[model samples]
Target: MLILSLGRAGDMNRNMLMALVAIAPLCGCQTSNQADYMQIGYGPSFDVAHAQCEMQKGSVDQGYIAIGSPGFVAGAGIGNALGNLAAEDQYMKNCLILSGWKRAPHGQGAAAASAVAAGTPPTPYGIQRAPGSWINTALLDWSDANNKCVAGDKAACGTRAKLGARLRAAGVNPAPV
Candidate 1:
């Protein structure tokens, strides 16, 4: 049974590779980080927010799974991967909005938008506006409190708990420190 399962796994991998090679030509275009979302006159600030969103969301690797023989496996995996890409795009959009970005108007290019007055939106839920920039204040406080808590500071632990709850109340999910 083990030997048979190994043989099947090898065959499935081979099929997946073949499927990828077949579609390689069609996927020649590389994915771009340049999205349609834009904040007017937020040149450097926009770059900063985009980087933060990318870091928080990270990258999703959608794999093509092959089950049966190559002949029996249709392009189901490719379709699934495409669906996942759509979902990932949505997630990125949500992250950008949550990070305080707005979509550019239709037919309005980034250059045109930047030429207009700055339209920086209010700081989002857990972030605080600093001198000339915005910062993740809640995350910073949480980190500090977490460090103190790890060092046996009971009050710091309570502070960390309160910060976490506050962030959750504001619709910000604070990951474990």
Candidate 2:
């Protein structure tokens, strides 16, 4: 049974390697910092991390990056290290987006709308209507908090919980209705 399991594990690893290689080109072209490309501009007045914590109302969960790239001999693990960072960066961006962060307009583009601003309309249970400014601040704050949380900071988790409580009482940003 042990031998059989080892064989399966090796097969799985081979498959993963193949997939990673296949995706490498796309990853290279796209770079990992999707959020940085977004050009969001938050104001000085808003408490970005706190607000994001309130609006998101959830915990941050991110994936781990593998160390040591197979391709390198001189600095074998550098590629893998970078890959891990990219993965984490993407994770942070996605986390913030889920928490209602909007991507700002880039040059030709106009200011991007968040889920609420877009009016896609979410479930009625915890809906809120806060000012766009506040929401924007929260969006940034949430991202920072999420980054800290993913980095294994326990205090950030507590902060998020506190923010959630405050929002529950006062209402949420994006126009706390």
Candidate 3:
């Protein structure tokens, strides 16, 4: 039984050796060719530039920058690669600075906070609405009514007055006169 066990172990070792030999070449397989790696390294600057532009466009665009995945991935990969490259590090640093990735005293977050403190409402352009606070029907209707009144529609003004009256009747205000 010991002799049989020894023989089986030897056969298993041989099979493992053969499997390793078979997989050696495959292990060295280049998923990304030289050209592909180069393309990945330096494919297009436009997308990056566009991303930067969108970020600098304002709070709306900044919100987009905060949430956008493709741009973040591309930027991070490129930044890491360039950061490793001694020759292009300076240029990449400048690019990153220009793209607002670098720290700044009066950057977007600070500016936004200041604006909020100043009682200014942030505009949602490219920014996504939060799930729970999405689409305030009352505010939308109020805005629509205001827009119609601004367009000189007497009916909208009357409708707005009626809404005000209803709110006043509900003990909400000093009663719409």
Candidate 4:
């Protein structure tokens, strides 16, 4: 027979919160570029840049982990460890910018609102496909499935097939993955 006081539970919760805050910086925080937090204008090759950055960062993180275990001294110093953990952040941002991302105006693509006010349908954004949303989804699905195929992830491939079918239904025949 045991009874826990509410005060004790509150104290336990407070202690847990403090512990999490203390360890926030030390955890395996995903390396990200400042640009990742920003909403940039349209970019045709955004997916390619994003994919490259993610692939490179993942490799960097995995390599560091594999080479820097508890007893390993390869990544000994704090600066070196942090560097290894975030080596690709800047590279990713640069890649994205180079891929045509730009700082968009605050009221980006206000044409839709203006068109509505004038009682006209707004044209699609420049460089964006018209009524091709399914193509984008299918492309993304195919890319993910292709990446996971070697890892024996058949589910992702099935998703790609479904998305491809949707694309075909939408009048854009996607190539088989």
Best by lDDT: 1
Q: What's the lDDT for all of these models?
A: 0.57, 0.42, 0.40, 0.50
> Estimated TM-score per prediction?
0.42, 0.26, 0.23, 0.29
Q: Where in model 4 is the C-alpha error above 4 Å?
A: 1-28, 31-48, 58-77, 102-177
lDDT digits (tens) for residues 50-99 of candidate 1: 77765655365455554554434635655655566566667667766665
Clashes of each: 0, 11, 0, 0
Alpha-carbon runs more than 4 Å astray in model 1: 1-18, 21-35, 40-44, 58-66, 71-74, 116-177
lDDT (tens digit, per residue) of candidate 3 on 84-119: 343333444344445323322333445534543587
**Candidate 2, 69-162: lDDT as tens digits:** 3332212233444565466556556654544443333531122223334753222112233346555445445545666776899998676566
Candidate 2, which ten residues in sequence have the lowest lDDT sum? 37-46
Off by over 4 Å in 2: 1-47, 50-74, 108-177
- Superposing every Cα of model 2 onto the true structure, what RMSD results? 17.5
State model 1's lDDT. 0.57
Best candidate, TM-score-wise?
1
What digit string (tens of lDDT, one per residue) describes model 4 on residues 139-171? 655665766765688887687677767777878
Which of the two, 2 or 4, has more lDDT? 4
